[model samples]
Target chain A: MDFSSVFLNAALAAVSPANLLFCFLGTIVGIVIGALPGFTSTMGVALFIPFTYSMHPATGLIFLVSIYCSSTYGGSISAILINTPGTPSAVITTIDGYEMTKNGEGGRALAMAVFSSLVGGIVSALALLLIAPPLARLVLLFGPVEIFYLALFGLSVIVGFSKGSLIKGLISGVAGLLLATVGVDGISGVYRYTFDNVSLFEGIPIVPMVIGLFSTCQVFVLGEQKRTTIVHDIATFSDSSVPRMSDIKAHWFNMLRSSVIGTIVGIIPAAGMSIACAIAYNEAKRVSKHPEKFGNGSVEGVIASEAANNGVTGGSLVPLLTLGVPGNTVSAIFLGGLLIHGLRPGLQLFTKYADVSYTLLVGLFIANVMMFVVGLFAAKQVVKVTKASTDLLAPIIMLLCVVGSYAIRNNLFDVGVMLVFGIVGYLMKRWGYSTPSMILGLILGPMAEGEFRRALMLSRGNWSYFCSRPVSIILLVLIVITLVGPALRNRRIMSK
Target chain B: MTKYLDEYLPIAFLYALSAYFWWDVEDFTADSLMYPRALVGVLLVLTTLLLVFTLMKKMRLPQSKDENSPFKFCVVLAASIVYVFAVPFLGFAVSSLLYAPATALLLGYKRKGMVFFVSILTVVLIYIGFRTVLKVPLPTVTLLGMTL
Candidate 1:
């Protein structure tokens, strides 16, 4: 456990005036952005990244991590208050959260989100301490082919996320794959799609693409909606709105189950908060005595979603710090942040950067603790953000999107990409298609295609290679379940 | 003013766009085929499937009732293309400064004061952040013959 080092360094980093203050500011800003329906912790990390380019690596890493942790919880505020998720991870929160808000129990919902987020964070941090080292040993077995397949597996989440239409998800995934092909082919050195532009040599930048998909598209949707104002009225809350001990006692099992679900999902590369929240919410509802209460402001529902989503932050880091494989988009950025600071994530990261690493783990733990305090104190104000009209915020957010997109590479072509995706997203949203699926496809499709093709070549065009390896077989089985399990359940419910 | 054109036209355009890309893939062989071919293939396949699905189900997709589709969609797409082409000539800062306000106006913002203030301020903020703070390169389009 490196108890001595973890304790000494964590203590040092946790209490430092500058470090502590940065953590506080990051959380506050993170919660604000997360409370806004269109902004996400992913966007928060992306937008704030340029700012981090100036700070020391450790300080910068701390700031970004703090934002990532807090923003996951912050999303529930909007979900509870306005029935719109500020982040995809909080989508499940809206099912029950908004119901509670309508019944004038928004404060309690918010409190539960905070408490659960904290519990999830703390539990996962301890797990991080116990589990990360062994995982690092396992990661050493990964070669380029294995890494490629892993990336592919991560991207396949699009299949599950693609609304009712796997075709649309496939389209989005293929589109992302094609874009990933831009620039000189990494292996062949052949220029596949650069069209004579020098900038295309490096391939389309991930920062630009991500910003385009999440932020710019967000702007377009907001602008089109042209909402002017949002209603912010909720019956005043007394101190009792803070989750009571009995309330916590009542949901302890739900909390544990949800946190475990969140951690497991979070550990998988590319399966981010949205997946965790969805899984946790479903499980919570499944075992609930009042299952029907799930979508109607059930406190268990709020706990399940929030805890599971934020739990991803800790679970995600396990793979990242141990394996250098990012667990989700935000973790990918965190990897970049680590690299920009002259740190490489692999096994040596533990031995060489142990103090810094432990400090981050501890900081993550503290960030969750702080999330509870800040969230509880600011729950009222946070709800007001949700109440703000999407129409008004959309344009400004669009502006911010433009700024963020352009800021990444100072390229307008990237901005154009954002607008393109935005329109596509709007259309998909209107059609009841799953944007998450498309995003998953877009994010993971190329990785899967590239790796699957490469793995084939390495094995002399053998398809059974994936099945032969125990881990690969297990993962493939899990992937199949992830894809088919939901449909089976949905069908069962419908038939009933 | 009351026409079905607004309803069916966009879908038809998408259908056409998908078809065009689908056909365009034949221009290159596998080695020559870039990622766009796969993307276009997926897009065409999905759009066609969606089209069929919607038709079979008698589903009518949602469209804005404001009769603003053709113009807004066209303008938005055009603005994006123009921004890309203008970048090397106008440089990022000046182009963005000009583009933000202009695009806002096109999106239906009417107040001159708001437009001008937003345009100028947005440009300045971006300039300070991208140029000054982050030190990201903001090239000026010197070839455009516009000095400022």
Candidate 2:
């Protein structure tokens, strides 16, 4: 809550001309990531990390923050113009946005998207700066048992809600957790699954694995599409500026409520932007006087969808920066960035690295403004990325995947790992398995194992100790809700 | 060509991999192997269930007939494998220069001249970005009298 020092330091760091330039560049790249179909924010961040290898930590992180924010906004451009969501968060945006586009309100739709995203971004960033410290303090009270259950909750949430069979998704997640154990066992110094390969001793490399899953697999998917055209036209409305103030004032309640929903969902590990947008859109439709107007060019739907998507940008960072755990796939990549810079995400971030942390917070606000400005001016130009040939895009992305895999640790073996995973990823996609759940399983497996072991050791192998603690009990209940709630909902739908 | 085996294809791969994974971790001590063993065991069982679910569904409903070619996918994938393996000996510059065009052609890009030009430019930019700017050593290989 102490603001004087953070304000001065953050001002100095974020306002610097070089940092501003990098932040601007990151926003542009993020917009591209968001505008391009199948180019996820996670993949973009992973691809860019190797480029930041030799830069200042503050500069690198601020740049990444810009990318994270603008990309969320960028997804709307494609969603509105092309009926294809550039990111999963924008999937809801497509319903109203494309409807509006078809109805010739495309300009107003894009404009509303930009305005709502700005409001959501600022609100979430403010929440991140003010609320994270207290949350971090609460997190400090958590025992190993609490953290272990939290990890379990994080791992199961995505699997439980996957598009196809929940059991099948859980299987994919289990496979990832198994892959996470492929290195030397930390407790006993025993080689677990290495099979005498020296590269396996350090564990399966996450960077290459993610690139394989998100980037290379996307390349394969693009090729499968054989798309000769992304969209025939953007509609004449896109050539103009944003929506009017009356339009903004009309939907103010939806924007504010969805921002709140987005922030809350973002703070919960693995609850993701898709959930945020869905809940927000559902809430908006329920509360609207013209509820039937939804799915047919409803401006309220656009506001709810875009605001929540952008709010997720700020909300996700809360759990990540304070708890040293990722809230989503993008934050998991951000965690990799933080670790790469030797800046751990918990208490040390707010105390020892407060200067860098505040700088990132302020930089995110600046990034939002930049996104709105860029979106207003360049919507016509940037939206055309969809028209880029799949043949060209796929090869270039695959090239980056190869180089990204090789660049990490300078290991060619990692390139092989990435290729194998790419094939596996493509097959998984074809099979409708949940990739993010697997990634979460891989990211959280070691943490879950280590914390569970520590909790048991502290209790002298008393299995009842975890259930006795309030935090652990609450977290266990949440995990139960995460798993059982979905199954029950599915059953209800089936019975109907 | 007559009938697609796409439904069983994924399950077949999963069964094979999980079987290998099950056999792979058999040698570790119980404490060390506990988590991985559980995961792989669950994967094995769940994959079996997935197979059963697919069969049951097919029995009740018509299976989707996939006419999409795996030709482009397999060719690009094989090219990537070659490019990755070749990079160690050929250097990133040479291998990627060769790889880019090959993949583009395999993907049915009709313009050969543009592909050739883009491939060269791509290699140069990558070399500068990774090798020169980032100072990462991208496996310099010696051919004839020159180190590249």
Candidate 2 per-residue lDDT, tens place, B1-148, comes to 3223656766777787677767776667767766666667788788888778777773122232333446776777777778878888898777877888878878888888988897888778887877886677676788887877
Candidate 2 ranges beyond 4 A from true positions: A1-3, A102-105, A242-246, A249-254, A282-300, B1-30, B48-67, B142-148
Q: What is the TM-score of chain B alone in each candidate?
A: 0.53, 0.75
Docking level for model 1: acceptable
Q: Estimate each model's TM-score.
A: 0.74, 0.90
Worst 10 residues of 2 chain B by lDDT: B58-67
Model 2, A1-496: lDDT tens digits are 4679777878788889878988888899999998987788987887777666566788888888888888888999899988989888999999999999888888888899999999889889988989887777776788899888877876777677666777767877887787788788887677877879999998888778877887888777766654544556665563345669898788898999999898888887777899899999999999999999899999899999999988888899998888765677788778767766878767778777888888888888988998898888787689987876777667777778888888768888988888888887887776667777787787778888888878878998799999997788888998788877887997899899
Q: Please list all clashing residue pairs in model 2, or write none if there are none.
A: none
Clashing pairs in 1: A152-A448, A155-A444, A158-A441, A161-A437, A162-A437, A163-A434, A173-A441, A227-A391, A270-A327, B89-B141
Write model 1 residue lDDT over B1-148, tens digit each, in one string. 3334533454575567555544544334554353455566667666677567656764444444332344544555566557656766777666666666676667666666766776677667766766675576555656556643
